[model samples]
Target: MVMTRAANIAFKPEHKITMLCLSSSGQFLSWADQSGSVSLASVGKNHTLDVKGNWHAPGTVVGLCLRGQRAYVLDDVEGLFCVNQQGEVDWHVPVAGGGFSLHEGPTDMAVVDALGRLLRVGYDGSPTDLTSQFEGILKAMYVSEFLVLSFEDGSVKALNGSQVVWNRPVRGEVGESITALGMDASGHLIIGREGYALVDGEEEALEMETWCLNGQGLLFRSDLKTRLTHITPGLGSVVCGFDNGSVTHYKDNQHQELLNTGFAVQSLMVRQNHVVVSSWFYLFGVEEGSEPWKIEHQGMPMLLESSNDGSICFFAGEDQNDWTEPEPIGFFSLKSEARDADPSELTEWFQRPDTEPERSAEEIYRVDETVENLLTEEERMLMEKPPVIGLDSLHAALDDFAFASPDDQAQGTLNVDAESLLDDLDDQLSSMAMMPDEGLFDALNEEVVAPIAPVPAAGEDQVVTCDEDGTAVVLLDGLGSEDPQNRIVMWSWVDSTGQEIATQARAKVRLSAGVHRFELRICDSEGQWSSDTIQLTLK
Candidate 1:
């Protein structure tokens, strides 16, 4: 048997939480919602949260980093903002694209934009551009005295200021890309869907092996059958969660299975003594010497973070329903054996007492009838007093239907030229009698041919490798399209983001290292159009 408990601290937000970050000391918590609101709170004794300040951003917050008394926010429309504890913006910078990643360093913040421009901003609102030093940064982290950056071409490098400490340019399979990068006590680790590598900073030659290369100072790699979803650095290794509901710790060229949650892991955190894993419906805390405790959540856990000292863990998510909007909820949990507290103090709002009577079927589905519920005010007014037909309106309609001649109406017969009508009928019968039987049969058997529409073919899916510049130029072919009239007048190519990239049948497009999907649309002269899709995998 395992012990179960409710969260010791809880908070409900007005909107769904978009991002969340906890400070290293576990004293301050910061989060952003869908409405572009950023909030900072102080964590007191007994895991209590006291909101200190709140600020609003111009767009949806994508990145949030909490340090000291300031919150660094990066939104989609706005570039970067440093909000102080008094809810005032200290500085602002304009960022162009939505694909920007933000990381906090020891002294400044590092930002990598969609165009691969790297910028370092100091605490005093000073900015430095280091874009020329690197090409297409996929991930960056400040470890020890060096900054480790991963590129789009599956290369990893460490830099000390403007100098390169070391470089590793090992490429993965066609559909495989780097998923996670971190520094452990052993070496630098790079994980992907197909395999992973651990590199130590040293000078060595290459030694090829069946599984992994033995060169470059303590490197290890192996294929993974299951897809990785979440990862976090452990004490001497790394903990990985998979889509198949299995968690494992990878270290020393081998991996040990931790526990299977029987569901895809949504979030993961590793502390000093235990590992906390959250699925869609439950949070599991696995320890060494005792049974793993499970806590049922009222919603799906979206965010999980641990303090630097591994003393407290924060969790937040949203309760989603079919007919209602998502409601955000958050809580914090203390490390096992960290402190002793009363269990009754932690309230579970979703639970009901056993003393309450169960509701009957009729009571559970009962709905009361009210005037406001049945009809709108305008509808009720229309129902109470219906419109009446006026005498003048009836008279106008009768006049419109009156006969044109009073003499015909009195005789109760219609005036007609009977002799001329018979003569016309005789002429029609004479013409029909003179027609050929074979000609009439052929006319009835004739088949109508409808116009054929154009068919668009986007060609076969392609797998292309990037060049030395970390980008590939591939030709999108739509010449395989077919049309009955051969009058295909227009051709359009659209990317996965719904943006038109080309207007010709065959065009070249430059793409970064990743997966890309495109759609091709062709229109003929007769205004008939068709579309098809093609996918490209860039390595």
Candidate 2:
């Protein structure tokens, strides 16, 4: 099945179902119930439908015929109402008395009513009674330019208005009634009576004299064991569904019995080589070698039709008592969906003559595994590791690390103290040596060594700038001469927890020369910090 079982829809229980019909293209299925309302449900992609009010007939819907988007419904009122796909009434033609039967034509409908009135309906939604020749009620009718009618005489009559063009009295023993009637492609009348022989007209019987008209009105083409309970034409086959739930296919005068369906066959339709049958709750399909699939429904169906896209729609529900309650009506299409199967099992299945083509192996047809998985290994290698940087690019490594984040400024200040402080003057001088061969010495300003520590006037501070490499040069200043130990400090970063990330603590410290928070504290001869501790941040 092309669609899944879960896709089935359930409607409100109280909405009565009157009739159901599908569009010619199978694009939509229009259903109407006792409320005289119709819903044109889309078959594929949904469309914005134009909903109409209520139906004119509150009675049970007897039959329905659709053309373009307009539908003609025959209901209990015995009248014909022209309704759009949305169930809105376009127009109505009330039969003078009551409608009996209706047949479709090229652009109009031929209607026969209970009063034995014959009428021709034009595209304009108007009715013109052509004749009235009824002894009782009109049961069945077939429409063309010329109409054929079965009357109380157990005879078939071809009529052109009130005048009879020709009449063929059915040759039968007695008591049997006309079961089915239709016209073949050659315009010869085909009738099925309650007796034995299957008959052909005078001209057609010449080649096949085996099939002759009998007194019981049953015509048999041959003495062979073949029974045709109901017959309908197909493109290349004649479909005759039997009473035993078996649909027989006849092609070139040969017959093939299909699956022994357990349900009574109600109707048969043929559109080419495809055969569509509507039995009790089951729908059957027969192709070449595949098993017949029976799609079962919950209600009894009254009509079946196939769409051009190969989907079928049928009417099923409560046909007798309550026509108001809508039943479950469904659409079915033949399509294959992907399923998971083992490779070897799938190969064996495809090798079987009856199985459909293997869609999962389509990629294997173009290339083998060696060519298909070419880029897999290379892609895995690329995903395994981060990109590598050369050792000479150590500064690039530091650039990747988040040093002094902007979020660390929430706290007050950061302080640092060293356990061992180098007091060698030469070591202090070496700290100012420039490594010009490397990029680290780019920010060195050696000229500031002469006035390393300067006494400042009261309330004076100094400003220092760092190079593009984030290295800052610090000089001790703003201390009185009474303080012998001059200290240079830089405050780099303070985290949210008041922890110092990196700070400079020395008389003259290189401190790896990066951004840091510094605190310069000058101790006087009494070993006291000048005034109070001061803090600054190096770039």
Across 256-348, the per-residue lDDT of candidate 1 in tens digits comes to 888888998888888875778888777777665656566666567667776876666777666543223544454545554532234442235
Please, what are the lDDT tens digits per residue for candidate 2 over residues 1-539?
Answer: 32111113323325655566667787656667756555655555432223333345655465577777777876546477787755577888777645656777665677765444566786578665555554322335543445666553346666655456655555544323444554433334455444322443311111110111222332333322323445665545355666578776655555578655667777776654556677775556665554555444455554565566454444455433332335555444443322333333422311234446666666657656565466687786886668777654654644533334446544542221222223444677798997476444644644454323423222223344666655443443333333233432222322222222222221222222333333333332232333223344454
- The estimated TM-scores of all candidates read 0.60, 0.50
For all candidates in order, the CA lDDT equals 0.69, 0.49
Name the runs in model 1 displaced over 4 angstroms: 131-135, 172-175, 193-218, 319-325, 336-516, 519-539
Query: What's the count of clashing pairs in each model shown?
Result: 0, 22
Clashing residue pairs, candidate 1?
none
Residue 23 miss distance in model 1 (angstroms): 1.4
Q: Which ten-residue region of model 1 has the weakest summed lDDT?
A: 204-213
